[model samples]
Target: MQTISKNITTLLLLSVVFSFGGCKKFLSVTPSTQSVNPVTIKDFQEILNSDSLSRTQFFPLDLMTDDVALTDNQFNTGDNFYRRIYTWDALIWNPAQIDFMYNYSYAKILQMNVILSRIDAAKKDALNTPQTKNLIVSQALTNRAWYYLQLVNTYGAAYDVSTSKTDPGVPLVLTPDAYALPARASVEQVYGSIISDLKKAAANTDMPSKGIDIIHPGKAAVYGLLARTYLYKGDYESASLFADSALTQESRLLDLTQNPYMPNQLQDLNTNPEVLLGRISSDEGFFKTYSNTFVIGGSLLDSLGGFSTADKRFSNRFSTSRFSPGVYKQNQLNAQTMVFDNSVAVPEIMLIKAECLARKGDFSAAGDLLDKLRSSRIINYSPSGRTYTADNILSYVIGERRRELCFHGGLRLFDLKRFNKGTPFRQSILRTSYSGTNYAELLPGSVLYLLPLSAYVLAANPNILQNPR
Candidate 1:
């Protein structure tokens, strides 16, 4: 794996001579085949169309959340790298290893910058007109916004209006130039850039009304991204509005009731109506490989509830591990079963809208929306039968969010960080090693919530400041 040092080297090289279509492996600096710099709209589109652009550039963060537990033998003898992450280690990376999340996110950001820097000057053919340019720009902007959002949430403090202005975020690298080492922008600035990009992307009406495919961003995808971004920023009203906008354009939730016990029913993004924009970890089988050693946490399992005709998410998505008999693990993530889609999707947007409604004292409306979503996932679900009191409605929504969204993207970690900023959802996560000899706890206000920059990253960029540990 190439570290930030190699990324910097790659960038310096690309600055001198632009190339493409080399290095099939993740983080390969040199392309095996080199093409000239993009001088046409088609070239820009080709760069954006690469599947690697949509792939999550980091190790999955689900290991760090409370939703996973370590098995006895594996925790004791398995990979130390994952164990370090599972225990929320202050420094998870060795000196020489690459920080995949940090480096690859910036790598994709560099690609976006390349397109944004010269799209206007590129030759426009009969088919690739100004509207085509707008569409390409929209996709690039949305991609950059999403990457920055992920980087800031992982490296910087959780967004707080009071402290965001000063809270250090990841470096705001905008141009294709890679020689200058930029300092971390504030969390507020990072968020501001994300929102600006999404809004700009959304305003480009020449783009398709809905995403052309799950891989590309369209108007609905832009709205969904904006909704989630605002939700992370703690702007409920905007979140609700944008989510509504997105759902209106494309709100096709999968009926989990139809295939309750099927192992891989929702694997195809083209057929999956709910996925607005699909993305997976670069190593898509990470979960499946890890399942031999990790099991679903007791609390998360309890929230999912026992086998029932009412709810099918647990039955369809999880099962006892064949590698470790009698232990339960999520069976439907990764390439073997159902590929997990971590990007903007219909169900998540619905959940966002429901949460916003509940937070705004519209419990009835929120309950209705939640029940509507539950009905699709749960057979014979009755809204009247659900005992959702106004007092516990928000908790119910959050609990459902946990059950539905766990192990997808790094959302659980993101939720924990943001929820800790308030009272109702603030929690102290406690876990012990398989040997029960060592324990790790993450308190609501702990500095450990903010991950430290890898030693490699710090070494590569002298101006970058590490997060407080």
Candidate 2:
């Protein structure tokens, strides 16, 4: 158990002061002063809406996976931090290498905890109406759940029903007491907390129907997050139901064909029709380095299928890298600096529904859903010659997920962890060396899937255990 005072100190030092130029509506109410503690619902809402705290990056996870390939020159010039992650080396033991994500995630969680603890005091002070209080509580709960999910998935083992009870998860801190000390909880406990929070959020009907700003979590975003959580848990039925609910609430997919390219303007979080919940990564500049170092994997490019050139996703989302002539870099976001999209979008919900249906043996239903998504992403996509049977439906759905969400937010790694559970679906991840002569492989049940905790965390808390190297 680490003292919460230490945690608070670390959080304050690492917190980024986010500017809200694009999200004026959501944060229209200005705070009195930073010196004053947040006691009003509006103040808390602004905290939740801060993209600086909420937006996160899992760039190391992307490097660990197979979707990215580094050029020889780029690899040699890259820092030891990234190289260590790419090779899954013991060098990652240094807190400096991975502390940004650890600190950033916990900082947001700490804010949520503070808001939750103070909401009652705010209510007593008549700082909020019933509706505003309920909304505040709901938003804080969901936001906390989201941060915990990110922490658990990165630090703990993949959620397996049989093993989750014993799997070491990140510490669960639910209060704002800076002096309180808490120990790590099991993976099962972490997920239980997440589900409980989401359920409470779902019951808060007073919450705004949609986010005044995309960065803030709304009703549809809650459903989408629930769907993602269940999908990771392998609860396909619940995942499907939640995905459908989310789609019904807000189903908007941008027609990429109509406007194939937006070089200077990559992510339109303010007006993007497809984004249900918009959150960018703190490492917005890392995208430029990532593009300089890595290119799309050959196998990943091949999986795009016959309409690769014709598909708007292919034509609009990628371009030849100036850094490496033979390499193609992801261009979905900023052309110069990549801004990773951590939002819940229409395509993800559709894929979740498709996957759940396939898992339930509803091949036709799943195919129909896949086609609907495909039609939107690909120009003139039709089902006339395509066939998706039960035997291959799951494969198709998985392929679509991979193609649709390659470098979105380490989603490929997450999916790999979930799908690697069963013997039939289990697969290995292999990455070749710079020369392509040697390969590093991560087996289905490899401990490497669970990232090692930052050395600072272990040093501060003797009770905390590090993931096996």
lDDT per residue for candidate 1 within 120-199, as digits (tens), equals 88875875687888998999999999899889998888899999999999899888765769899999999999999999
Alpha-carbon error at 397 in model 1, in Å? 1.0
Best candidate, lDDT: 1
Query: Model 1 misses residue 214 by how many Å?
Result: 0.9
lDDT for each of the candidates?
0.75, 0.72
**Model 2 alpha-carbon miss at residue 245, Å:** 1.4
Q: Per-residue lDDT of 1-469 in model 2, one digit per residue for the tens?
A: 3567676664453243222112223344342233235667667766765555435677667777777676666566666666677767755756544476776677677777878888887735455788878888888888888888888988888899999999899898887655445678999999999999998998898876577667667888888889999999989889999998888888877777676633322235656777777766534444455555356666776776532355766655456445443244444444555445666778899999999999888999999988887887777777887898989999989989988877666788787787778746677766666667544677887888877888787776778888888
TM-score of 2: 0.88
lDDT comparing candidate 2 with the true structure: 0.72
List the candidates' TM-scores in order.
0.88, 0.88
Worst 10 residues of 1 by lDDT: 25-34
